[model samples]
Target: MTQIATIIGGGVIGGGWAARFLLAGWDVRVFDPDPEAQRKIGEVLDNARAALPGLYDMPMPAEGALSFHDRLEDAVQGASWIQESVPERLDLKHRVYRDIQAVCDPAAVIGSSTSGFKPSQLQEGATRAEQIVVCHPFNPVYLLPLIEVVGTPANAQMVDGVADTLRGIGMFPLLVRKEIDAHIADRFLEAVWREALWLVKDDIATTEEIDEAIRMGFGLRWAQMGLFETFRIAGGEAGMRHFIDQFGPCLSWPWTRLMDVPEMTDALAQKIADQSDAQSGQHSIRELERHRDANLVGMLRTLKARDWGAGAVLKGHDKTLQAAGRIADTLSDIADPARPVLTVDRAVPLDWTDYNGHMNEARYLQAFGDATDRLMQIVGCTPEYIANGGSYFTAETHIRHLDEVRAGARIRIETQVLSGAGKTMHLFHTMYEGDRALATGEHMLIHVSLETRRASVPAPQVAEPLARLAKAHDSLPRPEGAGAAIGKR
Candidate 1:
């Protein structure tokens, strides 16, 4: 079945939604009146393309097509899901919803990406209003996994399906139990925003200071464990109740004016704009975005190792990705019996380059590791199978660097299964940029019982595929330096 998603606006949030759904293999139709909406969305998609795939070890679903529609009716015609992200105006939203209601598929679920409006507010005077829910997302939605799903009880049940769809695109759907003026995350953010504004208005701190306070402190903790868990840890093993009991009284102090609101005069807005520029004027927005993305990717990847918070979500999703075989085109699926398998074809990003403006030594190993992982999948030692405790562990690896690969150089790895008849599987990989071979690696791996953490013969399921692949490669002539590369013949 072809799943279709519709976006009724092409602003940041809408563009992000388009990227998310489109990348997840849903045909996406977008409608917006702005002349530059497509261009803007294109830019977002570019950023998304560069950042998203790096987050996963497994290949993502082949990208679904994205199209822009001039008419709202055209956009929502075949949509299984319709998301409205127009400017935050009740009348405008209601109009868009009406337009959508007339043309949208009868079974399509409706979501409005409004930060200020509750689901009840958005559903007002709209046809099939019971299906309208507020599906608020943060900025850079493609990177951030959180989405706050809010709806009235009567219509809230429909949101579960919406949550499932969001999950398919690697988003974490946070259900807001009750519809309120600003859903949960924003409410917390608004409180912090108010405090920050006061800090600025009072001349107590600069915008940079406030941001540093976040990125340096609670922000790091929140990214992984969130508030309650951090606080629970602060309780020194006594847990939540004890922590709350200990800190309850401090909450009564005048440390913050949570109820206070600052008047936003033109002068105040100018002050903020000026302060923001002063804080980060050195870097262009794109540069900053790339910097932010690099840090986030590094942080998230590290967290993946520990299986905590956002990392946990990413890790879980990668399993779903591997299980689905979402990418479809694996090296083995397209290999020729006459040639080595083309297991990896990717560009070395700027971040992967070293100080010499060439691909770093460790990255060469990582790329080969990615190729090895793909090989593991072809031979049935997939993430799921490995979870059951049988897989190959590298016992020895010898790499020869013949040339340097610079940043943004598209590289490929062709692998030959040298031998795979027993507990030991020997493989060879050569990295290339076009016809130029840059490096070669000879790897010797031993089948391991993950439960025992030692070498053991693999089960019939894995062994059979490994043997088949080895047999297929047995006739290929061995490349030069086979004996010198890894020593053992």
Candidate 2:
């Protein structure tokens, strides 16, 4: 059975967790205190639903249903994974964890999305302290893969295992050895941040210039190779020790005040804001997020084409979701029930008829496949998307031999994405004669990574649309052919 995950809190982070799990085909139950959680999360999901599909080249599997709950205990019942994304208040976190302990299964792993707070502090006095772990993810958890896992010794393995599970879903889970107060990455950021504040305070450079220095210079290099490593390369052919010998003196240079703390004042904020505006002008928070997401997609896609490590991680996550079961099936079965009829206008060509005095069987299949392709394109599947090393390959197909149309029959194949997702998509096609549905075919297609020639998931770019089609056709019950199992290709 596909595991069910429960998310407590339905704000941005919680909504992202919901999207990640839902798109990957895990049933999700979300609980939030705000009365408007459902409406708000729905909007977030809608935006995600549109944006996520373009990330992949293949069809997406069916998305999991999102059930909203007003009660916390109701959401945790039978949940295999419980993610706590409540507001970052120690007492509030403790209270929520205590409540979760009452309903969640003993084996279930509990994760807190606290950026800098230690799990120990958050788990204080909680009944399930042993099961608690901090799962600090960068904003837009659905797109970014970095998830820092920190836990006490009692549930450390469980936390690591959870990290592995997250890795399976295309997340990069960094396991911290000991539960530190601010955690690892944040500590690194703090040092640079402190120095940056000094740079601004000393008027060494404007905020934009500082940002440009990082992004245009070291930041581009850092995407593929991190800090110390880049410095080693700068050290030349003599390698690390020699490089360090030559540049080690710079470490003593009073260039940055790494330990300095910035006082939060209106003047400081204004100075920062003004400098930020000077750098990139002003943009609303929403615009910034769009710009970030667009850049992320572009960079990740570029790296993905090259099969670089970071890109590979993203690709693996996408493909793993695709290779698994049910996701694909749910996505492909999207059909328009209200309008099952399709019309076609074409002249009767003599070559279409066979010796059997009917339209050739091959031609019928060909015509129907063409129609299916068009329908898929209309419903979000496109050739440019499919051809770019990701596409759907038919695994199994059954065409019901119905009443035949003669050589003069002007027909069009009506089709549906029957089901969608990484490896497999279920499609239903019908050959229509004017108003009558003459023949029907149920096809199971597996998305193959053309590079690997193995069943793989479609990249997010491709999966998102199939998900939409699935939602639209969700009310349309499963057809008879849907139950037929697809054989190995």
Candidate 3:
């Protein structure tokens, strides 16, 4: 059964929440009085649809239904989760909560995308105080995984459920131990934001210069290792204590106006706006969003490859998605053994295309390689088996590029096991976009003993299943381009 999520506002943050929930297969109903709410949310969804699915190698769940409601009561009727993203005014939040609790399920989770207000504040005067919690997410909520979940001790179980729901949608829920103003990440961000404002006021750096200082320097380190871990490495052989002892004395220096707030006078505000306009005003906001999304996808893919930091979160989400039946799990899951096995089903990521405005030649091999890996896993050559000293090594490969493919295109690969006997496994893989053939790859692989680094016989566990697949595939018509050498066609 599809779950329902209600959005109380349809601005950037609210739309992001809607997109995240909808893409994760939850039916979303939105209530926003703004006449243009649907159009605005549609724009955000467009950006999300292009970017989010590319993060995974497997298929995302089919998007859920989205409906805009004029009445607040209608929107919250049967919703399991209600997210309030209204402007940051306590009285307004209290009013919204009163209206929500009147119609929403009493047991439903009411989450606030409040950056500063605590749950206790949001729950004040509400019919059900325990239902509300702070589920503050970063901008571009569909991409960035961090969500600060703040609730009082009385709301502990509700907070846990909120975290589990967030993880289901590929989000990292950092439960705030103590409900505080601005939660955890925002407090750190506020400090930096305050200092950045002062630097611009003092003429020390322009907006672009400040951004450059971050994206070009500590920001990269922060992306993968974060603050303390990065600093621990900076400590050299002694670790955190030694580095802090040496650099801690500099805390007393007058290098920053961290505690001081620069007055945002009209003149100062204009100056900053003018500088920012000069820095990045050439591109439209949507273009800038696309650029940021592409860069983020690339960086996140790197981390996912290494299984570090935010990348680890993405990796774990992929496993969760796979377990949810996005892909075939075992030989029995294949519906028709007479046909080739469906091995890969995913969208081409933005990074896979090049200056040619088409999928790069190398990415074809990468996709085919993934298909081969999937087939290996299906026939009992799983990660655990490989770890125990048995795996396939590609000895030779032939690829034929049949048609052009581009980023954001959904593609699939079907594999035919031509032969699987003794120490060798030969595979014929065909790539497709819908029903159109995009490419084909023929590969010859040898089962190897990882310990001796030499070709070796397969274990019975792997051999029997692979042999069965090969026998099943033998009755099917041979692939058209299976044996053709390069340039022969």
The model with the greatest lDDT is 3
Candidate 1 structure, TM-score to reference: 0.86
Residue-by-residue lDDT tens digits, candidate 3, 1-489:
879999999999999999999999999999999999999999999999888889998888888999999899899998999999999999999999999998889999999999999888888778878899999999899999999999986688777888999999999999889988999998999999999999999899999999999999999999999999999999999999999999999999998899889988999899999999999999998899999999999999999999999999999999998887546767888888778999999889989999987999889999999999999988989999998999999988999999999888889999999999999999999999999999999998999999999999999999998999999999989999887863243
lDDT tens digits, residue span 1-489, model 1: 879999888988999899888888899999988999999999888877777776776657778999998878888887888888999989988888887888777788888889989888887887787879888998788778889998886685687888888888898999988778888888889999999998988899989999999999999999898888899998887788899999999998999987888998888788888999999999987779777876887787778879988888889898888677523243356546446777776556556777787778898888988888777787778888898988899988888899989754667788889988778888899989899999998888999888988889988777887788788888889887675847565
The Cα local distance difference test for each model comes to 0.83, 0.72, 0.92
lDDT of 2 by residue, 1-489 (tens): 778899898888998888877876789999887899888778667555644544553434567878988787788889988999988788888888888998889878888888789988987897867888888887787777788999887676687688887986668898888988779888888888888887787788789888889888887787767778888898889888888898789889976677558786788778988888877677765567666665676676677777775777867765664454222222344344333323222323334567786777786676667655655555445677666787777777777757777643545565555566556677777777777867777777777888999988777766776666655666665665554544544
lDDT computed for candidate 2: 0.72
Order of all candidates by lDDT, from best down to worst? Answer: 3, 1, 2
Models 1 onward score TM values of 0.86, 0.65, 0.96
Task: Say which prediction, candidate 1 or candidate 3, comes out ahead on TM-score.
Answer: 3
Please state the error at residue 424 of candidate 2 in Å: 28
Q: Which candidate model has the greater TM-score, 2 or 3? A: 3
Ranking by TM-score: 3, 1, 2
